[model samples]
Target: MRRREGENREATNLNVNSLETLVTHIQVLSGNIADLTYLSNVLKQSGDWLQSEQTRLAPLLGELNPSMHSLGYLYILEAHISAPISKEQANELLLSVARFINACTAEQIHLAPEKFISVCRRFKDQVLLLDEPLRGVAPMLTALRKLQTSCEQLTALHPEFLLLCLLSKSYKTGLSILEDDIFDFDQPHDLFLYCYYGGMICIGHKRFRKALELLHNVVTAPRLIINIAAEAYKKYILVSLIHLGQFSTSFPPYTSGAARKYLKNFSQPYLALVESYDTGKISELETCVQTNKDKFESDKNLGLVKQVVSSMYKRNIQRLTRTYLTLSLQDIANRAKLNTAKEAEMHVLQMIQEGQIYATINQKDGMVRFLEDPEQYKTSEMINCIDSSIQRMMMLSKKLTTMDEMMSYDPSYIREAEKARSIFDFDDVDSLPLKPDIDAHLKDVSSSYDIDD
Candidate 1:
């Protein structure tokens, strides 16, 4: 019994020594950045020590020295970012860092804006590189907000903070930053990251056009990174189907041949599904998606692909509107490949509300009456087109007039025109055949010909 008690005392002493060593390292790192290599090593040691000692120290450490714990976490983050850590190690380090950041008071975070920003930026980079969602993103965003409140000027220094905002589902904050043009990406990867996250945010807000535009930027970047481009293409295709009912004709023209080919090869399942959708082969589309279900899930795109499938029935139903003056819900179910009449009715109601199809439903007979009068609709559309054309032409005229004013004031342009006129004059002089006699001879010939006539 005495020996066991002695062992417990020894373990307690070891824990105390470990805690003291970690505190010392954290203090040294906080005071200096001259030896980042040594600091990195010490911080890593501190992290390992903290992990082993966490259960025993959790209750007392918060009250005894919270600032020390926070600084120690900052050191661990700095070290993790500087060193080459595995994905698992990075994740674990980030989890600890996040917890520490969250535990700190807003005032504590505000007081250390630089350190907070440093940690947030590094954490954002890791999250982006791993291409996985982090659980602790909310705390990171909260800490960033506090840092921003403390030093608004420093916000611009870390544009990747917007990424953390988005990841934390802080869409309003991210959108504000995006609108303000505060994000400045210096690297190709960073640009892709911004577009990818921005597109997702747009998707969440149901801004499909803006989402497509952002994803298009990612897929069509000059230095195309395959994984990001592939993911962007998947989202682009899904969003395109949702927004335009088909891929826009203008989309392919912007993409390079290599990108197109790569997309075809890498995204064959999606391409097949799109073709089946366009051709109105509902069964084929369903089968293709089902067969590639694992692939879709692995790519994290199963939900989007399923959405495409849901939309296929709508497209088919819309096609029926063109051919039939009226379709009963049963007829729509049969023609649109829907499972039941109720499903067809729901789709038709939604389409009517969205202005995709003009129709009124009869609740009694379950009949759908098409309200579209082709001739009147055509005439109104034609008038709208004419009005739009006139507006565009007026804008074009203004633009041309402004351009002419600028050209008129350009000395180089005026000098070039004078030079061109002189050249033409010299050519005419050279072509005069060195004789007025040539002109007189031609006149005499013309007069003789007139007399002969």
Candidate 2:
């Protein structure tokens, strides 16, 4: 009886998995056929039939067990709704999908290729074979393989990579089915992959028009795999379009507030700075941000802007670090005394601009100095003091290490080691220097301090 129960459980699990797979495959197939209808005159008659397939699959999905994978599947369906879907709804769907995938992983559920293919074949029987999927068989298989590979490990926090791959295939496949040869209908999914890959490749080749055509179809995918893909691809497409000087056409989808602001981040600063005189582009950037005011004001959008700013700041710091690493310790120490190396360097720059500090490079000695300010001199002095302290600490650590080795090997040396270890002095030459006004940048450096109870 127990053995029979185990077999029954396995069968039930398989049934659920098969159902989910079929529903997803049918959904994609229907989406492809609908897309092909718009592309060519021949497939126009199959438009209603494609919609019916989606309607049919939706119910089948509804019948599946309410597990995380099922929920994730439903979220994908939600993402397929008609144009002008609300961001809140779209985001909710994405989040749900993410959570569901995570839950499935947590439950130790794993999906494999064989199971997926079996489900795909079943779906093809009812959906594709019934009315001839616009994209032919080979293209569809290739596209599904790409999608399956890309969609692996869906539990990852950023599923956008997988989503992009899937949607790209969907878009490409649909376009292929619209091709002249009816029997040559490239599998909608594989065609989608070709378009996506081709677009990116075209961009690299500087074929802006070809890239735009491929990407535009992706943007217009009715059964969009993920809202994030639309927003992401749209930005790239607009960038390419703008590069080609198709400004009006390259603008943006006016409805999706998030995508608009994101695109602006790329073009806005340049528009504001270099094109300051170009009132039209400036107006365009301003209009986009203002139109999305509510989205801009929302915490989510604010967080995104904050992330961009943070990334830029970190990049600047890295650039400075690389620059500083090349300067000699003496140069660093000299710079540090004035205002800490970073500030002193900036101050020197300011003085040069103000004509207060001029470079005095002696040709005979090959020595350089600045006609420095008193404040600059103090900053440089402090920097040197800090550098000396650091050197002293390094020397002390080396001596300590030597002393430790001696004590570890010699009994008599233990006493000296104990004494050395017991000697605690705030004025120890090796002590890290405390800035007079370190409180000003307390938040920046305080975390580096090690405190022991």
Best prediction by TM-score: 1
lDDT (tens digit, per residue) of candidate 1 on 121-240: 656556655655345456555665555543212252233554554445555655654443322233445555567667766765657788888888877765565655676787788788
TM-score of each: 0.52, 0.21
Candidate 1 RMSD computed on C-alpha atoms after optimal superposition onto the true structure? 23.2
In TM-score terms, candidate 2 sits at: 0.21
Q: Candidate 1, residue 34: CA error in Å?
A: 24
What alpha-carbon RMSD in Å does predicted model 2 have with respect to the real structure?
27.4
Evaluate all candidate structures by whole-model CA lDDT and list the values in order: 0.61, 0.36
Clashes of 1: 0
TM-score of 1: 0.52
Candidate 2: Cα lDDT at 197: 43
Q: Which has the greatest lDDT?
A: 1
